[model samples]
Target: MVEIDESHTSLPVLAFFRSPQAGRSWVTAAGLVLDTANLLFSALDVPRSRQVELTFTAGCLAVNRVQRFFDKKAETQPTELRTPEEVAAANPGREAFAKVWQELRDGGLPVRPDEEAAWQHYQALRMRYAPSIEFLSQLLLAPAMGSLH
Candidate 1:
């Protein structure tokens, strides 16, 4: 088991270790919705760019659905935020996000030159909108948690 050394870790990374169950559930739900959209898009003869747009829309819808489900659940059952250590104990999504981040850093995740600007803009907006550690975790870990075994 890998022990997270919080002293050396940034706040954003530590945030992923905070809500394992919610993170996993939200991610799985979003992945299901996105996968459905992907299948539907593949069957149609839409242009590649249009397909990408629709996929993005599908992802947004997934987030909204997850938020709604959890919000209602929250009303009936309050949840306390877990500490980083507690969350990391059973959370695989944190490590998965770390691996993906490393892959991006090593240039393993590539974007075409034509799309580089759009990618950068999207990243900037992501950071802008994710104003807190918890918010950042939801955005980063959801997809990762959904994909994990």
Candidate 2:
């Protein structure tokens, strides 16, 4: 039983085997978040921005790789049962991601640490571009489009 916050990057990968569509959605959501963070950080450091976005992107990439692994595995399913043994087979991407996600799981996701410097920078960015950002974020979170849950 994997426990993850709604915004956790691993959320998508965890859903991969169980619900591929959901997993894909999580990946897309992660991409949007990463892209936003990168765009924000390009002009300025934004304090903890680098840490936050990097962590998210790392999770996203790892999960995506794992998802690709599963897709390949599904294609080569030896038995209709799709046993755990099949899933445990050698897959470089999945193996690497498993290790990282495991550590993250054990330690707990960063959950946006409260570093004063980072927060101040983030606040300044938000204040400077509140309206534009709000509009863009709204597009990202639009309910009608079936956003990441």
Q: Specify the highest-lDDT model's number.
A: 1
Model 2 shows how many backbone clashes? 0
Each candidate's lDDT (Cα)?
0.37, 0.36
Which runs in model 1 stand beyond 4 Å of their true positions? 1-26, 29-48, 69-149
Local lDDT at 130 for model 1: 25
Q: How does each model score on TM-score?
A: 0.32, 0.29
Candidate 2's C-alpha runs over 4 A off are: 1-24, 43-50, 76-149
Query: Candidate 2's residue-wise lDDT over 56-132, tens digit each?
Result: 55644444444344335333222233234422231113234334334444665442333344334444533333332
Give me candidate 2's TM-score against the actual structure: 0.29
Backbone collisions counted per model:
0, 0
lDDT of 1 by residue, 28-124 (tens): 4434444334323332233446765555564554344333333453332224354555345323243543443344446544423333343344344
Screening candidate 1 with a backbone cut-off below 3 angstroms (N, C-alpha, C), the clashing residue pairs are none
